[model samples]
Target: MKVNKDLTATASANLILDELYTNTGSSSFNLEHDFFYGGAELEIWTMANQAGILLTEDTDYTLSDIDDTLTNQASRNVYKAVTIDNVTYQSDDIYFSYQACADFVDADDRYMVTREDGQYWDLNSSGGFDLVVSDDITFKDQYLASAIPLSESGTTGLEGF
Candidate 1:
């Protein structure tokens, strides 16, 4: 199996849970995808222009979640942002960044599982590297499809790296 490692900081600013017309006054929202696991600090701008006023945890919003299990993670993806008094966001006006994972694949077509010590957080913390892969996984001995063509620099000059 191949894992697609993506540390992309996709700044999603699509919907506004609160507005003058709709007036949902929503207190929370979810990222575009689940299984976010963990990531960098969250980022939120009140204006489309990204004015100097950047929102933060506790002061402007609150974020929480415990990605301890596969089934428990999706619910943890919910992000709760406090309302800014009368400053209702009537347009595209919220953004954030975090580390995420779509962890079914691995880099070298090698198979991996989150079943280390029989826990989900093992993949992120603990001895994740020590996880067990069943014998079903077949190794691809050759990393390169063809022989490497050296510049002959190694023999020509020992100084060449």
Candidate 2:
């Protein structure tokens, strides 16, 4: 009879190695935290509110849930986009930056994004939107380096001395 054993420890180590070297092809143990920063692609629906354009939960632009924040180490820097008459335009894209929130706790769930002209808008039930956000984000890892690598020289055999 054969018994199966879990390789949790080995798997954990491999997971760490893959993440560190997935982009650079080499692991860097010197990172203060195991937060590997990477770029992620995202698409959010938008709508024109009373003030200006804002993100909507669904393509209908009638949803109340507004996903205004990209929860990362830093604020999610987003590049905006819009669709009109079944045609997309990139030049008319909007840029929204993270600003102060009424409550930091609420900010964790969803925060406000201000326009480049320093204006914050409210969401309204208007046309549907197609907003694309591509930004770099860093995530934290639980593991830490416990040991350093040691060097060893090859052994030469001298028999019958």
| Predicted model with the maximum TM-score | 1
Best by lDDT: 1
Tens digits of per-residue lDDT, candidate 2, 1-161, equal: 11111112122211221111112111112121111111222222222222235333223111122224422323433212222221121223322211111221122222132333443322222211122121111112112111122324322221121
lDDT of 1 by residue, 1-161 (tens): 12243334342322222221223244454343333433233455653444545665555555554344542444334232233323344233554444344342334333222222433211222213333233222223233121232355422111111
On a 0 to 1 TM-score scale, where does candidate 2 land against the true structure? 0.17
Count of clashes in candidate 1: 5
Residue pairs in clash, model 2: none
TM-score of predicted model 1?
Answer: 0.33
Where does model 2 exceed 4 Å of error?
1-51, 60-92, 96-143, 150-161
